[model samples]
Target: MQTKGSLVGDLVKGGIAGVAGTWVMGQVTGYMWEHEDPAARQRYEEVTGGKYVPDRTAEKIGQILGLNLSEEQHSMLAQASHWGLGAGVSAAYALLRRRYATADAAQGLLFGLLFWAIVDEGMTPLFGLAEMPQVYPWQAHARGFVGHLVFGVVAETVLDVFDQAS
Candidate 1:
């Protein structure tokens, strides 16, 4: 039988694992964003009528507050939200895993896809921070899909490591 304190400890560990996963995902995304073909970036800009940048956490936050922040500030805010969301998702995953013993790659992939659906395709568009995913260039969408895939995989791996260590 698991103690309440143990459960809470697992949640904290899982959240940290999620942050690690998010950091890895962020690096992959940052590299892709930096090295994407100019033509492809141009196409994205044309379709979105805005700059091509991965992770619109700041934009969504700004939209909610109706504040137009500078580019640097927006980037900072985006990073903060991105990490926070990653941790929250991981913590929730940890709790679910503890209950269901569903700590595997397939589940992680599903979690990532779920996030893509809810946050990327749903909330962002609903809040006017982004257009519907369908409207973006196919390549852009593919990139995002892969990034989330990495996030899920890494998060699950780290969570398992934490479990083993404990």
Candidate 2:
């Protein structure tokens, strides 16, 4: 049996992941992404008449990091990631509260992000601990900034649910 797969626990954990990741990425990599550039991707949406736009994590860190996910790609990817994250965090949060309560889901969400950015990212590419080789558009970043927000928000909600339980 899983010890902490409940809604609250998962949300709390996810939130922690976001904040922690944000901090470390900012400090270590000196890069943080929050939104897509209006110039490139924004124009594409206008041209294609696409309804979706890329949203950055903190503020598209592309300029700073010199890594290219592009305006169009970022916009589409962000949406997919956001959806997945929301689902994952909410599900986890609901399950967590069945067993216990924690007064720190928001903090938990933050921590989860921070840990993933600094520790988790390196696990695959850095240490080769295990090869996850490839991931989908959203999965590549779910654990990044996109997923954490889902974690934080959902976890916070789950914690509130736990409060009701008690």
Candidate 3:
């Protein structure tokens, strides 16, 4: 098993990386909207269920990074990038909890998805942290469900590695 210290390292590294990576991905989405194929926008929009607004996405990402991407498709790409980052965070947290059974993974996931809603959809837009549109309760659930499940699985796998080491 990894020493407890290493586990903590994983937790911190995972969380920090999740946040930073998510931010960059948001910006990248903004870039893609501007530079990518026109049909890409329609595909992205269809996939995102019309939640992909290029201007708002660009505004949100620019607010976080202090940069501008006015193109519609690049903005969409950044928003799209969030799927992986969200999944990574979920997976990392799941692993952390697995490593330390005492870790409150349920709580972590609850706070995480809710945070995604309030912060990503609610507070970010509320405070102009990001210009993205607000999410409804159901959408929050969707984000929570997919994200937490992925996280749980990833975390379980990580713990399995520890078990092997032990």
Candidate 4:
């Protein structure tokens, strides 16, 4: 069991790892998008209306807060929301890892899949933050899955590094 200080340290490390993982995931997905079938990519763009889900989420948040956000503000908020979610989720994952060794069994691959399923395939649509999974092409799902797998692996690796350093 980790002492309180070590747990906090782990959480901080997890947040850093999450940020790193998210950045790498974005790069991977962007590359996939660039190389994707034109037809499928066009279909995805059409279905998504060229707007990012995080942008939609930011807009919705602004509405709830009764604040009218400018386009620039919306974009900034969307970015912040994206990074914040990544960090927050990974921090929670760190806590889980400390409590249950099994959580680290697959070097975070299972956690990544679960995160993708629960957040991407489930909660986003359930909360009206994104379209239903069926609306997207198989390639989109595949890209997301691959990106998340990378995220899991990268996060786990970073956490391992932290462990070794400690």
TM-score sort, best first: 4, 1, 3, 2
Residue-level lDDT for 41 in candidate 4: 98
> lDDT of each structure?
0.77, 0.45, 0.49, 0.84
After TM-score superposition, what is the CA distance of residue 79 in candidate 1 from its true location, in Å? Answer: 2.0
**Per-residue lDDT of model 3, residues 115-135, tens digit only:** 455545665456543444532
lDDT of 1: 0.77
Better of 1 and 3 by lDDT: 1
Question: Comparing 1 and 3 by TM-score, which wins?
Answer: 1
Every model: Cα RMSD to truth: 3.2, 13.0, 8.9, 1.8
lDDT of 1 by residue, 35-123 (tens): 88888878888877763223465776677799989988887887777688889888888887777755678878988888777877787
C-alpha TM-scores of all predictions: 0.79, 0.31, 0.40, 0.93
lDDT: which candidate is best? 4
The Cα error of candidate 4 at residue 98, in Å, is 0.5
